[model samples]
Target: MLEEELVELRFRLGDGSDMGPIRYSSALTIAMLKERIVSEWPKDTKITPKGSTDLKLISSGKILENSQTIAQCRTPFSDLPGGLGSGGAGGGVITMHVVVQPSLTKTKTEKKVDDMPKKVTVCSCTIS
Candidate 1:
C-alpha cells in the first residue's frame, strides 16, 4: 500500500537570525521520528506546542510523521511576508507544512518464495 503524510513545522531559532520557515520530509518510523525531532532540537528539547499554527499561520503542534494528518493542510502555500522579504529582518513566525513519503518495500529476507513446494514434511510436523 502507498503511504503518505503531512507534518507541521516550527522553525524556531532562539538566536533570532530570521532563517525563515522551512518544510522538511522524512521516512523514519514514529519511534525514529520522535527521536529525530528531539535530537534535532537545540539540546534535545521536546517541544510541547501550545498552538497548532503560529501567529504567521505556520503549524506548531504534534504531528504524525507516518500518517495522513498532513492532507488536511493546504499545499500551494501562503508564505508570510515578514523575515523573508527584502533585507529579511528579525524573528519570523511559525507556519510551514512538510510532506513525508515512506517506502514500504519488503526486505530480501521477507521476499516471497516462488520455488517452494506446495507441501513439505518436517521431522515431526508436516508443512504446506
Candidate 2:
C-alpha cells in the first residue's frame, strides 16, 4: 500500500494575517479543516470566531465546500501561507482566505442604539 500523503494549508484572515501551514491528510474534509482553524485562531486578536459556522474559507477565488478534501482545494506549485516557501504535491502548501461573518449581536446592538433618544439633559431652574 502507498503511504498516506500529507499536505500543508494556511488560513489567511481578513486582517491579512496568516494562521498556519498546518499539516493534514490529503483526504481531510473541508468541514474538519474549518474546525482546526477555529481552534488554532490566535487569542491575541480582538475578533474571535464564535464557531466554524461563522467562518468561510476561500481558495482560487472560490469558496471551498465542506465535503471537499485538501488535495481537491489546492493549486500546483503554490507558496506557503506566510511566504514560507514553495513546493509541489506532497510538500506543497495551499493558502485559503478566512472570512469572518459579523456577529448577530453587533447588529442588534446597533439597532438598539439607533432607537434610543439622541439627546437628554437635566435642567436646573430657580423661581423667585
Local accuracy of candidate 2 as per-residue lDDT tens digits, 5-91: 677778789888898877787788889988988898998887888888778889878988899887777643345564323333545
Error of 2 at 87 (Å): 8.3
Model 2 lDDT at residue 92:
52
**Cα lDDT of model 1 by residue, 4-102, tens digit:** 332334544434322334343323344333344434534433333222221122334444334332333322233544432211123233344322222
Model 1 residue 29 CA deviation (Å) reads: 8.8
The predictions' CA RMSDs to the true structure, in order, are: 14.9, 6.7
Give the lDDT of residue 70 in candidate 2: 75
Model 1 poorest 10 in a row by lDDT: 49-58
TM-score, candidate number 2:
0.66
Best by the lDDT measure: 2
